[model samples]
Target: MHTPSHDWITTPLTAALLRGALDVERTAHGLLPHRLPARARAQFHDPQLAMAESQPSGVRLAFRTRATAIELDTLPTKRVYAGVPPRPDGVYDLVVDGRPAGSGSVAGGNTLTIDMTVGGAELTPGPVGTLRFAGLPDAEKDVEIWLPHDETTELVALRTDAPVEPAPDPGRPVWLHHGSSISHGSFAATPTTTWPALAASRGGVELINLGFGGSALLDPFTARALRDTPADLISVKIGINLVNADVMRLRAFTPAVHGFLDTIREGHPTAPLLVVSPLLCPIHEDTPGPSAPDFSRIAEGELRFKATGDPAERAAGKLTLTVIRDELARIVEQRRADDPHLHHLDGLALYGEQDAAELPLPDGLHPDAATHRRIGERFAALAFGEAGAFAQRN
Candidate 1:
């Protein structure tokens, strides 16, 4: 491990040095970036939300320096599943002057062991580790170190060969997005490659991603968090979580969706708000969920999910992707008359049946890395293009 010496300069990991995070928590070990504010966190708490918010999906350290070597000390909480192959270490991506520079990972950290069969988790504490990146151009330029999207990483320390100052703002519009796991980059190869991150890059905007795995169920606290956040362009991708978790019926979902949008409009009434429906997931397309893991392939090191609710249950108000999409479209249409800036985008346009046929969802849910890239590219063209809803008007 590289140790900080007299020649090295250490910088404090403060809010000014971070982006895409709503709050910075001072932990026993280090500073933890949270996607949701402290007040929102206080209202409701879940293990899934806690883990998701702490992962720092789109969060990055931003600075300008001539340093050729950089070292970051982090204590990452890695997730492990019993009786399955170990997942690779979360990746730390380095971007210099707005371009991919290098990548690395920490070897050891705390582990959260999860047993899918019983729906239980156990945390085993581990030691802090270091991530090192060296051999840069040695010229003054913008630097960004994107944290691991899937790991709960606490920033312990930052050191570099040369001094670093907060990078000058590029003056891009800030985009705040809320959605489910796919939006959270579940199968993405790296933090930067996450669909939202990629879309932000292509759209020339700053991103604050609030995509929680299995937690985007139209919670009021989350709506308030979005309302409180500062954003120029905003989008809410709904449906999958509500369906798969079987949290709400159609009777409850419509009002919840309306209320969610209403709360956001309270803060950003005219900020080109886009309402997006669910992407194509055949398992839950027509069938209602409460999805459950299929452990049959567990011995082969594969885990898949199946919808548990019957399709006939929809008659009694059980929600599904098909029903949710139609409701979302109707809701947006109903509100757009009074709110000119409000618009709707069918998730199918981004990743529909045709695209799914070409690049099927690997685990039957989240999009793969290539699919993420395709979605990002398609989103950029659809939502940020010249004729798109979020296009900059002259």
Candidate 2:
């Protein structure tokens, strides 16, 4: 595809405007978005870490162009969960001049199918594909293509009818957020519609999302990454991952929380730092984890998570969702006495028992698309609204 005014000029996708991913690696074919830097990634080889970090949640290409037609070539690694409904193709959202203009999806890509029952995964390789968009206004304007939050994508090339360049910073304050899978867009409908994405949109903030799936376990490395990242506003949503993964007992958790915040404050002592607790997860509220799948549903062509740890274990210092929330609240209250910018938001305020009853979580874990929308809207109103914490700054 060629235009008289311009020959194809493929700009090297550098880190200048690639907001979400922490690091990009040169792959054999193209570039791979790694949520964690090489130093951190080298420390852990867990498949869960690999899968979550590679999803590229909140990743996108942002630039300016006069092109009426644009083509993006990418090699995506799509995930398929066996026995559950086939996940839809990951969506790429195109925003022209700050408003949604169109959307596209790559046709073919590699497939990673996971059988949770047996804890096995297999990848079937596929080839690169292109997403072409035309019929633009044909004037200089900002253009953004948000990559699918659920799929890992490798950029092959980008072409356009007109020359492309980095989009100018819009001067919005950057919001750097870190949380668990729910924040990583577990069941959000599209890349831009993820709860955090939606909230960022409504709040009019530049987003640098650090939302890793099950990987938000308050690790020192993640804290260091947050410390190093530049931002005007920062938020850390904790608790859910700790409960679900059941990785630490209360003895380790309390101080871990302090250390995480301590490290972040090292770099951003005055930035508005909001610590969010877990939302309502009934199964894990009183019961401890690590959560396991209910295989009974697979027989019916469905799958859901169930808490496996005994509730009685809580007396022995086992962490549950309930216990985690109280601890987080206490920690934030104690710290805010000296750190005035620090704050806490009960995750239940985002999604409570009533909200769950109305918009039930399909997997007994992650919220569905509708729930995502509700939470996004509420969060925008609470955290970004006129009387909200981010309101005055923005």
Candidate 3:
């Protein structure tokens, strides 16, 4: 807790000062940013979805200020698995004039312990913590405090030496993207370094990310939420979560993909819509899943994942990354006959066989920080560069 200072000016945390969040929920302690609106959240009861949506993967506090010193009070919910050592505290990245200025993390907040084997969790309350950045240039500039990508944080207070106001819109095209854990910044080191966030920066676009951790199952409610959102460019990266969860077979997967796209078109019929398939996961490239945790290295404080289903199951309509990609390509090709703005990108183009050989997925699932940068760079080139699907029209 920070002591009250006479020189500090307190600002009310309002929705207008936030970006990339679909809703601002009033909590007992403060305001919580949610990626899914209340109505869309009401349609699902899954705890994974709830947790992922509240984690604020791409959400940030934005404003214009001349403050040389700034402090933000937040209540962050940190997660711990039962057997593994506690993960590092989530990072808060500060950006000034669209460039990285500094980074910090709250010291303490709340704790949530989870037993993955039993699917149970225990919550422990903790005190709010403050993140401070000082010695900034005292010139007028746009500032943004990016929340942690993996921790649920509630904004309790905003304090600065100088007054602040909501930043004016930059007038960039808005890019709304939906994907799975990789897109959700699973193994990303910081909020601003996430692949989607990096890509958005390079593309010169505003980002509204709906990449839920383990909850990107292409739910109808999610589709509707995407539909209702206003954006100029849209993309959906599919397959990883579906394959790992084993939620649907080939028969169900194809129609679900089509339906998800159909819903988005209802709101953005002319927007550039790009459909991306899964990246190269050798374990699930041909084999089906029901991925299982590989706890063999748990004693070493390392956890890995493996595909549990057999490759032969593909004959029975089992879904795999390769299968999903083929089907997605076919679906996009067929739909393009009627929809000229629709496009398809094979996820391998972002991270292919050569990439897996060089920078293998640390957990046999999500990419590491280096891979995130590579993917982000590749995506920006393919989606926003000249002649790309989302290339700005003259």
Candidate 4:
């Protein structure tokens, strides 16, 4: 799986090597990023990708490089499933320089191991281990590694023998977004296909996805995260998660949103900041969320979970997607006079009536991959197209 740069492979390390190298750290995790290998037997949206027998999930490391040498370093980590007996299965496929260099796993007795087949060395987890593939063929090569059903794995570090490419050209108007797990690519297949990534690719912009799973709570941390990040276009997909998690009351939600938007505006004064409401979730569409049912058996004896909110409570307008969407529209309208570039896009436009009817969400909640693609296409056209007014904004 290794291909050095054709003619450039013969060149010696130059001044770039003497200069400090830039490390491109791992971005998304296996299940989190929804990446799995073809051989991976079974997969699900839960945090871990469960595989039967020897099947495993795959992880790829890709970085644009102009460096002569590159190395990958990882530490053994395990995931603990909180089942009856606390099942812990830790196994990973280590691929470096495009070849299967080694395999790491938790032995039958739950003993951790790093087994290098060629050297017959079985090292346990104590000191950090290094798997180095030297003399990479070219100035740029992707070092991919795959991991199976493993618990919380930490990519310890990445080191380069030669200099790396300058950080992805920042000249492109970067779009920084913070949203729910859906934006984080819940069921979507690939990293690049996530709504945000897809929109960025189509819009020809750089993207920094701050879409933490179950974490976009009109919180100051998220607003500050966006405020600190540099971006030409900004968007916050709010509502679905708030209603799902049953986090805030309507009274508190409004001001919290205003504060969140205010914080972002401080950093990006004139940038077009699009506020997107939740896509239609049938269950939450009619019935306000904080869905309280033990849906475990429905998913095959899986653990039953209770979402926040009592429909009766929402009678008091505690928290509802409808309420959120209405208020978001109001918020943008109020600000439009003062802040001309601020805009709002209803989630329905992305996956509204027509799209929903065509691509019904598998569950009553999240849209499938096809729906995601449709959403991306529509978003690119409406929100970021050549005629998209955001492009004209300062």
Candidate 3's residue-wise lDDT over 1-394, tens digit each? 7875999999999999999999999999899999999998898788899999999999999999999999999999999998898999999999999999999999789999988778899999999999999999989999999999999999999999999999999898999999999999989999999999999999999999999998889899999999999999999999999989999999999889999999999999999999999999989999999998998898898889999999999999999999999999999999999999999999999999999999999999999999999999999999998978999631
lDDT of 1 by residue, 158-249 (tens): 99999999999978899999999998889999999999999999999998999998889899999999999989999999999998889989
Query: Per-residue lDDT tens digits of candidate 4, residues 1-394?
Result: 1233443232222222210111122433212222222222122232212211111122234344545454433344432223223333444443344444454443222223322122122323443344445555654543333333223333444456555432333356767677776776555654455676667767876566656555567767557657766678888999987887677788888889889999998888988899998887766764566654454554352333344555677768677777788889998899899998888988887887777778877656666668778887888888887666456632
The TM-score of predicted model 3 comes to 0.99
| Candidate 2 TM-score, C-alpha based | 0.96
Judge candidate 3 at residue 131 and give its lDDT: 95
Best by lDDT: 3
Q: What are the clashing pairs of model 1?
A: none
Q: Give the range of the ten consecutive residues with the poorest summed lDDT in model 4.
A: 15-24
For candidate 2, lDDT tens digit of each residue in 263-283?
999999999998989999999
Model 3, residue 329: distance off in Å is 0.3
- Which runs of model 1 end up more than 4 angstroms from their true locations? none
Error of 4 at 360 (Å): 3.1
How much is 84 displaced in model 3, in angstroms?
Answer: 1.5
- RMSD (Å) of each candidate, 1 decimal: 1.1, 1.9, 1.0, 11.1
C-alpha displacement of 165 in model 4, angstroms? 4.0
